[model samples]
Target: MDIAILVKLTSRAWSLNILASMNSGIPGRQAPLLAATSASRTAFAQSLDHLMQLGLLERNPGHGHPLRPEFRLTKTGAEIAQTATRIVQAVPDDTEFALLRRSWTAPILALTHRPQRFSALKSGLITISDRALSTSLQRLEDSAWIEREIDATLRHPFPTYRAVNQGFAVNQAIALVA
Candidate 1:
């Protein structure tokens, strides 16, 4: 899965969680998804709508009442949902879910899989602002998901970031799908 695509899919809170829940065999109805993701009704509805707009999910025709439509993943959505499931499984607990929910965290972690400098990471996630990238890097470091190491071999030493611990697991999950 491309980082850009993943980032877009996860821009809304609970979107990834919703996909993971469905991929894990949960029923496609609203009630089950809402329960599985633990998202507020408004947020869940918005994420569901976002996914539908992206064409990753759609209303299941004739399978559910108009007031309670069921959803099914499109072909592209199923593949992405499988990746989302793996990434969710890699998270150690609910605390980490907050980090993953951030727009840049998962994409940043994925980029750090091979170790990258701040500028490199920012470039990889084209639209991220400097402050947003820096904040995300700090949060990931604080969570011990990534390590910042200063490289002295070069004439101008620079800090490099690499995924570690849970971040490594998530990166590996993304790698498997990619």
Candidate 2:
């Protein structure tokens, strides 16, 4: 997905509300800031549900109010949020990654040393167009060189690409031949 689109979907307005309310130790109630933007209870509920599905939000059971639930980021969700922030900051203000098919082997390999979201991987060095990035990631996945978990923690979400076991086995075989 495009970083711009991702940012819009995971806006500061939504993130702050979830983080603030959780930090404030409130149980299940929407933060005042989010409540202002939502206007209606239904809208707020829908927004909350969307975040939950993204794995960026979670609910905590309220001791007193069964209906009024507390929401917070799951570990994976928090990592994605932080990684998103890094991606935003890392991209040059004036330039979008325009090149495609340019070798991303170096950066991709480095990120594989420590699994990270696609955004984080992109942020680390190479800047390629969204399409190219997607294609490359898909190719890696198809090759069984990487695996992604649909609902991972904040520290690792989205396409947290890693060296597949098969990849390692192949590397070992190649090393032996060499």
Candidate 3:
């Protein structure tokens, strides 16, 4: 499975619940499971169907009760789940850091000095939401490309940020871009 798809599925409460239930050898009761995971019945059904098509799950033969159908993971499903877990756990904390470094090249070169926030950085080169900008900043900071300082001027202040030594590489790349 694609890492992105696996990540999205694992992160969703309903999918994870279903996976966990299957892992534990308990067949999920569709309606109750959907209710517990706060997912729509249609969405839950779709996810289950997709898993089934992927050879990750199978519908158990109906027992005496025709109304209740049980679902269980195949051996391949267990292996996929294990692989997904390993991949997710192995992801670096600064997952977006490299992308952020590449993205900020132009702005970094244009700036006489580093900006205090990604909003300040984005103003010149690209349009991004405040939330996305903040996330990028956090990623850069986590990767040691930037450092944060307390801003004393703002009431109920936020941290001020500036590029660290690692940003020099980004600056150099930017200088070469044109």
Point out the higher-scoring one by lDDT: 2 or 3: 3
Candidate number that wins on lDDT, 1 or 2: 1
RMSD of candidate 1 to the true fold? Answer: 1.0
Which residue segments of model 2 deviate by more than 4 Å?
1-28, 31-39, 62-64, 83-178
**Candidate lDDT values, in order:** 0.91, 0.47, 0.51
Worst 10-residue lDDT window for candidate 3 reads: 84-93
> Candidate 2 — worst ten consecutive residues by lDDT sum?
93-102
Q: If the candidates were sorted by their lDDT against the true structure, best first, what order would they fall in?
A: 1, 3, 2
* Sort order, TM-score high to low: 1, 3, 2
Best by TM-score: 1
**Residue 13 alpha-carbon offset, candidate 1, angstroms:** 1.7
* Winner by lDDT between candidate 3 and candidate 1: 1
Report clash pairs, candidate 1.
Answer: none
Model 3 clashing-pair count: 0
How does model 1 score by TM-score? 0.96
Report the lDDT tens digits of candidate 3 across residue range 1-178. Answer: 4323343343333454456445544545675556544557776787777777667777766632456676666787876655433322222234432243233322432341454554565564344457656665676666666677877787876676666654545443333322
